[model samples]
Target: MARKVLTVLLPLLLCVIAFAGLLLLSIPIRNVREPPSYKYGIVLDAGSSHTSMFVYKWIEEKENGTGIVSQHSMCDVHGGGISSYAENPSEAAESLVECLNQALKDVPKKRHPITPLYLGATAGMRLLNLTNPAASASVLSSVNEMLSKYPFDFRGARILSGQDEGVLGWVTANYLLENFIKYGWAGEWFRPKRGTVGAMDLGGASTQITFETASQTEDPANEVRLQLYGKSYRVYTHSFLCYGRDQMLKKLLAGVLQRHSTHPCWPVGYSAKVFLKDVYSSPCTSAQRPPDYDVSAEVTLSGSGNPILCQQLVSDLFNFSSCSFSQCSFNDVFQPPLSGNFIAFSAFYYTMDFLQKVMKLPVTSTAELRTAAKALCNESWEKLLELAPSQKSRLADYCASATFVHQLLVQGYRFDEHTFPRIAFQKKAGDTSIGWALGYMLNLTNMIPAGQMHFHKGTDHATWAVLLLIFIMIILISLVMIFCFARSSKTQSAI
Candidate 1:
């Protein structure tokens, strides 16, 4: 009975031992070096005005202590913002997905399995208050549902706040600075001293300001401070609810009509907001039109032609602009409680004046503000001329020792000094205006140091590969040990 029982149990014992031996043998032989690569992924930065999507493949780089770091090279899809999606979520998603599908056409089928798609929304969706909660929720829900139906690997989507948007732009801009420019300077253009640097990002529905210590610090994390300006202020983010170009124009026109019984300047019942929006939103370009309502009209009205009327109009516009900020207490323009308009214009005018007339920033304006502003404008025009590729070689020869930079400084102008001179000028030239100055101050206060921000958060390819290899090796070693144990059990049973 004992011998029979031993025979029956022997096979089972041997089988277990064999499995252990196989695991042991497989352990050292397992392929532990090569790691799997996760295929490319798509990232979407959705803003109030526009939505940009990029398909990126990771490239790994090795550092001494950091092991391997991965960065992405993008293929982008351009479109409108969440507002577009708000009208029709599925439609918007379909358009975006189609763009993504098109982008992937060049990539081989074998690389498709591991790709990931991530979406992030900012400004537009975030600003939706109780008034439009249903619309906003519908927009987001539709986008989520549509994405869920797709077969491609999806990470997820998130809607960020205004302050968050500011931070993102800051991170993106600095990354460009680190990767492309590789140098730091004061103000819009390069200056001698490296003072505090400010970044003001004006979006469709909101604006953000980021401030940082100009000089690179030993501890990168100690650099930026992000806090709103006033009690009602919500950090470096000041989102003027419905103060976009279209909205502002509408409000201005409505206010003008309400105040004046008849049309004050233009024809009666002329809706600047509606007219402008229709013209801009149309597929047709200004060049294809009569050019009746161009910047020239604004320029003529604002400039020397009719100073009193222009000033009144500008003041009214300024007053309207001031109302957007909840923090402002002023009512009458330049009266009891000073209007933000008064502050904004005076500040900008004075600062430019100081830079051109007093500081003599370009050394030619004798530091006169007006002269410098004019010079800056002229310099911008010349720079545009130089930028034309057709005139490149000839223009270079004729450009001569004529310092366009100095010429710009002498005019007391603050335009055409940077890549986006218009934006720069808008901020710098209007530094004195309460609204512009407030924007600048907001930007200055929120600046952060390099390295403190992160654009991506995930395990790099190398680390993931190493972890996978280690896991496989442990499994193999267990199998080998089981095999060896099985053979010993059979020998013992034979004895």
Candidate 2:
């Protein structure tokens, strides 16, 4: 009886070991499955001049990390930014309806419920917050209420801090350049080889400069530490309020009126009439206003087409001598040092593009840019209209804008001819706009996870079928052998 039991048990144990080895070999190494679904997110850039809505989408899950976000569609709202509607805050909410409706059609209906929607007011609202806090609150409240009415998951509407704006713009530019997480040629992801690029953003009311820096920063406030895609960065950023194109023009006009009768910053053949109040209405030029000056007094300005005077007036906007730090970039702002290449967008792109268009040549160096701006300034207003008939509304602004950019880059930031060529004037990075809105969304993913995909890696269908069959066979054979052994042992004992 003992011998029979040993013979049966040994064979059974061998069979069990063979089955276990087969199962181990047949098991899949990874969990593989198809992507769950595509996700959507929306961000509204409420800038100083206008409001624009951007729709972005990405897959739920990606092998590398979070899904790569891309701009799906864009709609520029028909009116100024919400800050402009301070008098009637309700109008600000109404102004977004057209663009919101357009976004509805752009994004599919099924995603409306889950699509995260956000609104970030830029320098425009920041100015409004300073001048009229109550109105700013009302406008923000109205927008929040309006956004909540839509099917999208309305997050919140608020003004982005200047530091946040500058840093996020830097992130957006680097993200687009693939400087953050670059894709290798061998189908793998890696960090960039050359390094991160800097960001130069000029808007209607403000301008921002940000770049990676390793030097010990004198002022901690100007430094921003950011981490994305499992990588960390230390950068210096600063936003100059009232240094943007529109406000800068106002300051230029105010300075010209205070000192001289003729406007030297204006292009030749260009002239305009504006009220004294219009020139000094904002906090930017209020100090430049005359004590007894009449607000309603009409003042007329005509261009003298002088590049030297224009550059001088543009240079006057900053105070280069007030730095308490070892090094400064005008206005006593502590900047360690400008590092890497820069992508200048927004007003920078427009001014540089206009220079290129009028000159019909690439403006590479500061000297070449100066030549083009001087040539454009000296050209009669009628000639400019003929050269760019459709740009008539903007041609008058060409020379002054160019001069301001030159002074801002060369004098203010201390960028020389060699560094100037490193600047790439671009409005968009591929199909995506180079701005803080996309960066805001991407950064938010760290806190609130984006909709992700479900993936699993396993054996193929045929292997699964074979494994399942073998598993069933093992179970049946083990059960049958146990029953036969029990019956045979009982029969032998009875006999």
Candidate 3:
């Protein structure tokens, strides 16, 4: 009897041990292995004022959703914008070499072959395309030729439409906040709110305004339909060419200054030889064509350091009269009542940061901003230099930039003092700078696929469930076999 019992018990004990071993094996497998390899991407933002290269990395297998992609490193091409090299188009491509080299150093050599490289020229290139088609082609060709030499997968380099810029920038801001991943659009519990913050990008050549509006859009041109993580978003976006602070300043000064003039915007002891062609180049000019002036003519401009006059001059650039839509920002572009908060970056943040630092004014106050800009304008050029040493090249423009920001927000965008506080002036969100580049990469990569939701939770849950079921089957089978043996032993003993 004892021997029979031992035989039946032995196999059951071995099965128990085997199941325990499998559980232990799973624990180590989960812990011992290194994380999945991360893939890389590079996006070069060739704007009007400058070119910036961003290196981004994401886990290879799980690059489809939010929270996976992030800016690895950013390198700024140390000179004028790529468009500035219009006359010498080849140099524009060559300018990227240093930044590309930095990318090579930043990312591992093994990743070089597979990593994607993209270049998207903004309003500057668009202007170049309009003004000088031949030069624009050469610029694009030059950049494409240069990018091909690198080991990275050279995605086509081209100009991004102004509307695309606004939409993508909006995408970047929301994705970084992990909105899609958290209160998911595809999941069983789909709670879609106006959780996304609006994006206002004030670059050197253009300004973009994009946000979600509940009202039905009348014009298809103003509407952008985007899909991310199985969720759909109808975003309203518009980019005003020549409305950027840099271009607007030129337009304002052109209207305000004569051949020999005292510019109210500039600080004391500041003067520049402003070229007539430079100011007339933009389509934003009232004449809608280049002025009749010697292409070689230049105007000598000196400063009277008058802030009130500067504001008045700048205000002339905005035309609030014509509204094709129910409401318009300026120049007959549609803009609904501002609803959600906004993330204003680029030149907007740059000028604000300077004022906040120099004048020690709270960003929330329009009154304080105007006061500080006026004070800064009245200050001597020497004192201006002392206050903002790093911005030596741009010091001359600070007074005008600050005042322009004030007018652009308050008068142009119609952001009230109450709503003004909602427009956060920040260069970065955590480590990443708030910009369109990240969003551009996300759009191209199809990180947010159109229909299906790629979730790690589902994959992990399925895997764990399968393992658990297999373990249970093994235990159940062992118990059944042991029972059968015990029954056979009892029958044989009775016989």
What lDDT would each prediction earn against the true structure? 0.38, 0.82, 0.81
Q: Model 3: per-residue lDDT, tens digit, 195-300? A: 7788999998899989887877766798888777677777889998988877877777777654226888888898888887777766556464445667678878
Instruction: Give the poorly placed runs of model 3, Cα more than 4 Å off.
Output: 1-31, 183-194, 285-292, 458-495
- lDDT, candidate 1, residue 290? 40
**Model 2 TM-score, all chains together:** 0.82
lDDT tens digits, residues 1-495, model 2? 688878578658756865785666455443356535667889999998899999988866552343467899999999888888999999999999998999899898998998999999999899889988999999999999999999999999879988999998998888778776654433334566678989999998999999999888999989887766566678998999999898898898889997877788666777889799878767788779788989889978888888788778888888998999999989898888777889999999988888787658567998887787777777788788888988877777778898888888888888887888899999999999999988898776552233332223355556666776777677668768777888987998899
Find the 10 residues in a row with the least total lDDT in model 1. 335-344
Best by lDDT: 2
Write down the TM-score for model 1: 0.42
Instruction: Enumerate residue pairs that collide in model 3.
Output: none
Candidate 2 backbone overlaps, count: 9
lDDT of 3: 0.81
